[model samples]
Target: MTVLALEPQPLAFRVRPQADECFDSWIDRVAAAHETTRPALFRHLGLEAAIASLDLARGTCGLSNEQYFAVYQVIGQLAWAVEIEVQQIEGTFLNVEASVVLPRRQRRYVCPLCWQQALRDGRAPIIRKEWILRMSWRCQVHALPLCALPVADGAMSEQAVGSWLSGAVARAESLRWKLGAHPRLVEWNAEGVDTLVRASRKRFKGEKKAYVDRFQANLFHFAHDRIAMLALAHSRVGKATWGFERLVALELPGRPGREVMTLQPPKLPPRRWRISKGSLRPGSHDAGVLDLVLAYAHLRVRRDA
Candidate 1:
């Protein structure tokens, strides 16, 4: 007697991706609906190998050509298994060019208020794609500073995410002011951060490179002036306030066209200013630092005019 083989069936509980949701966020929700971990879900769907090959830790942004091909192939399989349109799955991935202007986040950050809203709405909280961008310091909707939580190194299970959200929300409630951006930082964000980000998104290679170079030059000058001001202000206070001393030493100074290194406390010895052989290069600086510099530069230019 011969036996017939049956094809794998689609998932019974297909959770759709939420708006502006990252790929991992969508997968976590799907895994929770099925009451399984992400790895187990992928394995059961026969996509363990394909999923493993993709470097999804930092997310779908800045994928190489080969990685893009892998994504297309894997998403096809993923969509079929989930019984969703391939476009729906593909929409979760960000196809932005990797640039220093918008660097990938080292760890996840979320808005506590947003998470609470999602819970109240009877849905799993999602990690927004915007929050993963290192430059995104505040929630556009709530106007609250995004809270940084120490997440597990890689993709997390739904239960783990829930635990993290709970802790983050509690922490946010307790230390709301502490987590907020400095008043100056807030002013900078309001002035020029968004404009700089929009300009950085130019598509053509030549145009993008030119714009980035100009941006970096402005950033270097801004950092130079801002660090000096921070150092002077902290020294007069006889101590650092709001981590300004650290901000004086923050990586921004070293990145500017002229390399400026500040001593700890920024008051002990004179700052050692040196000129680097080269100016700012693309994809070589932190997004947070760039955002700070951009804000100062924009405000400074406006004031000068």
Candidate 2:
């Protein structure tokens, strides 16, 4: 007896994934636009058990190269058919340091005006990559700060981006289990939230390395005046993790700002000057530490200039 091979079926409706649009968002839209459940779609593509437990949510793609291959090889072109780019999915995992894996948490934020426009244009809302920057909170186009939305009960900011506000959360628990994850990853919060936390530079051999180490060591004792003075000597620029969205805002080349040196402490540390961890990219601990270091460099430049 001979068996017949089933041909792959095209989706009932096609909606191209928006550029830099998230994985979860793409899948949700594709399923909804076709009036189908995700399971039915997966079964149609012979991927019912492949991504069986893969929750298509933001920051769900913090994958190692091996994991990427394992999942993609199994799912094959079905993932691509939905416009999922294999290379850029890890854009959501914020800190790549081997030493610390902060606790898993959910955060939600959205540019209200941008969403309104997306609705008018019949496009799904997106959690653009720039929104993940520790230093970026305000939408340049809207000129209003990204507003926080409730994670559980509020409306989805865009597509499924409503579930991922900080742009820094880990992907799904099931994905981490299936993938070949590195041994060092863990969720932690050092000290009583204001104690010294350290991480060795994964890459080395530069003046920036020296400065980075120096700043990290003194994270608990900051001097605003001294930091402001050190902001000038080195011009180590930090670029946005992602590029601009079309019809959103003009992408400007941003560098370390001299004004960041003047940042005021939210509250006097209890004899411990550890950084505050916030949802905004600029307000994140990494930015706080770097701001002081950059200021320190600026200080030396001013003293001799």
Best by TM-score: 1
lDDT of 2 by residue, 120-202 (tens): 79777765533432222335464444544445553344646534433322221211122222121110111101122111234
Candidate 1 clashing pairs, residues 3+ apart or interchain: none
Local distance difference test, per candidate? 0.52, 0.39
Q: Candidates' TM-scores? A: 0.54, 0.40
Query: Cα miss at 169, model 1 (Å)?
Result: 4.8
TM-score: model 1 vs. ground truth: 0.54
Which lDDT tens digits does candidate 1 get at residues 157-198? 657767876776654443333222344444444333343333
Q: By how many angstroms RMSD does model 1 differ from the true structure? A: 11.9
Q: Report RMSD for candidate 2.
A: 17.4
Candidate 2 wrongly placed segments (more than 4 Å): 1-5, 36-40, 48-66, 79-107, 132-136, 149-305
